[model samples]
Target: MNEIRVFCPATIANISCGFDVLGVALDSVGDEMVVRKIPEKGIRITKLEGQDLPKETERNVAGVAGLTLLEASGYDGGFEIEIYKKIKAGSGIGSSAASSSGAVWAMNELLGRPFSKIDLVRFAMEGERLASAVAHADNVAPALYGGFTLVRSYDPLDVVSIPNPPELYATVIHPQIEVKTSDSRSVLRTKITLAQGIKQWGNVGGLIAGLFTNDYDLIGRSLEDHIVEPIRSILIPGFDNVKSEALNAGALGCGISGSGPSIFAFCKGETIAKKVSESMKEVYQDIGIDHDVHVSKINTNGVRAI
Candidate 1:
């Protein structure tokens, strides 16, 4: 195919206790991208719509990611990327990740999949590094691997795709506020107590076990974040109320979606997911904060041709 159009799912990173390691893709919300092979020898951002963003090849996330892939592949021809941004930047829902992963994924398809998923993630990390000054893969891994992914290690670059419970659903609330990943990270403390570290490790292990064993209750209990949430929650408005109301609405668990501004809750079914959405919105509404909410199943297909 000379050109490819794809739907790149938005992802929820850090998943409470997982913190830079675990993430899942949302089926309902994301960005659309169209990639085309070009005779030119370099990447370009041909068209950008939806959000006001940089279109320059060197400045945009998609461009940076595409360029990384192009450099790695040694592909003689270049590719042009057109991004239709649905996820707002700095909303903490993997906005940069969708663009970055989508661009590289499309280019990989056009080149007949010369690189593996892991390689694509490494390429996408460049775009993330440009955006947040850190090459974290919590968002990009899920956007590429789909369902749930655990970043086991960075040195060897091992990413493990986890099996999600079939009935799992997610309700996400994005308050119309910008929370740049860099700014959010700035609020985090550099140190944690040994007790907190042990608790976090146990929760991470419990969460993975809950998913593997289909234990919804275990998942809920394990969603607690001892280290990051306390400091980061201060950045988001009505975060405590949102989490409380979501649990009351029968959500399995609720936590900040990424850094801040967006919160996500896991539910057993769509009905509870919608109920959780209402609960999330109610908090924002009472506070007179503009917001966007979405209820979605775990997207088994992360980035796909559309």
Candidate 2:
């Protein structure tokens, strides 16, 4: 028998304009885990904390990811998994992706570490798809590689890494509101015009280039969205106020993190990050909603064994 432990950091995917192709890891929001290998050929999750996480391996996000890893790596063994959930559910913080990444990472270690980082991301995305009904690489990439990543390609193969950026700070605000992924997806438009699509691609390209060059102005200017956010932003109260407040508070760039309710802002330093967090909180407060705010730096390492 063998034991393994892993920690998966929460992530902000899409980052507004990039939509399904960008993400970053947050140091404060995440999940923890402990695992033990068993002789049997089935999986079991014995414990889970935080609200309403499934205990049975068959029904759990981590369990699905573990199964995916086993299939990808050709391994069979029972796993007893314990989950410590730090990120809140429905926070737009990639909670499902974190669990999936953690499980796959832990299982890989227990099985002598067979899959590569991209392979782990693919497996984790598979598990997330089970939860969200879509295979998105945005969360999985940062959960596996850390820092700010551009999912340059995702399909039959996934390729990405941290882009070079000046020291950056992120502020995340999660309002205590629940919006199901299915509902969020339903609100989005399924089609886009050629002009709007081209603008989005241009912004995405600028974002990638800005990261590589540490160009804050370019990054801020490029944080434009012609799709997704416009539709879903309506679901969140005080969204416009929050965004306005963040930028007014000196965030280089700010937008909805993944979907709704939880928002993230990018700042040049801790001072602006804290200010942005406060501003975001104030917006929510004015709207009569309770919220939690975190000011954290980029987590260069996505998930780690502890």
Candidate 3:
């Protein structure tokens, strides 16, 4: 293929209970990019739209991801990338992951699919590092692999796909506020007590089992975050009110999406999902924060040709 266009879905990293280990792909809200092969030898970002973003290849996540893929594949030919970013940066949703995954996904297609999904995720992590200064795979893995994902190990970059509950729906609300990712990471404690750690791990295990067994209540009960949410939710306006209302409105659970400013809840069905969305929005509206809300099923397809 001389050119390829790919759409990569947005992602929710941490997923409340899992912290940095788990993430899920959303059906809507993503970034699109087109990669066109050229005669010259290097990667170039020809266009960027939807948000004010760096156009430089090295500074841009999509460009850096595409470049990384090219280097790894030993491809010397030139390519130009055009990005249409629908996901907002610092929304706590995986905006950077969408760009990073979209670029490498399109690049792999242009090069006749040279890399595995896992390798593409690895390249995307490098792109993520450019944005967040941390080469974390929680968001990138789900953006590449779809559904729910577990970053079982980072030393070898091991990512495992977890089964998604068929009836599960996600409600996401992105408040129009700036919450720097660096600031989010800086507020986190380096360590947690053993009791807190144990509770978190137990919840993580329950969540995974719930997904596999289609146990909706187990999934709801397991959505507790004892470590990250308490510290990070303070950064988001109306976070506690939104989460409480969502749970009261039939959401299985709700918490900060990734870091802050974007909150997400999981519901058993579309009706409950919509209710959760409305409840979350009401809180934001009361706080006078401009926001965007999305209710969607789990994206089974992460990144795909358009």
Candidate 2 vs candidate 3, TM-score winner: 3
154: Cα error in model 3, Å = 0.6
Q: Each model's TM-score, in the order given? A: 0.99, 0.95, 0.98
The better-scoring model by lDDT among 1 and 3 is 1
TM-score of 3: 0.98
Q: Over the stretch 40-130, how does candidate 2's per-residue lDDT look in tens digits?
A: 8767888888868777776788898888777676665577889889888789989888999988888888888888888898888887887
Candidate 1 Cα errors over 4 Å, as ranges: none
lDDT of 1 by residue, 56-173 (tens): 9899989998899999899999998889999988888899999999999999999999999999999999999988889899999999999999999999999999998999999999
Which runs of model 2 end up more than 4 angstroms from their true locations?
Answer: none
* Reference-based TM-score, model 1: 0.99
lDDT of 3 by residue, 14-49 (tens): 899899999999997788888899888888899999
TM-score: the better of candidates 1 and 2: 1
Ranking by lDDT: 1, 3, 2
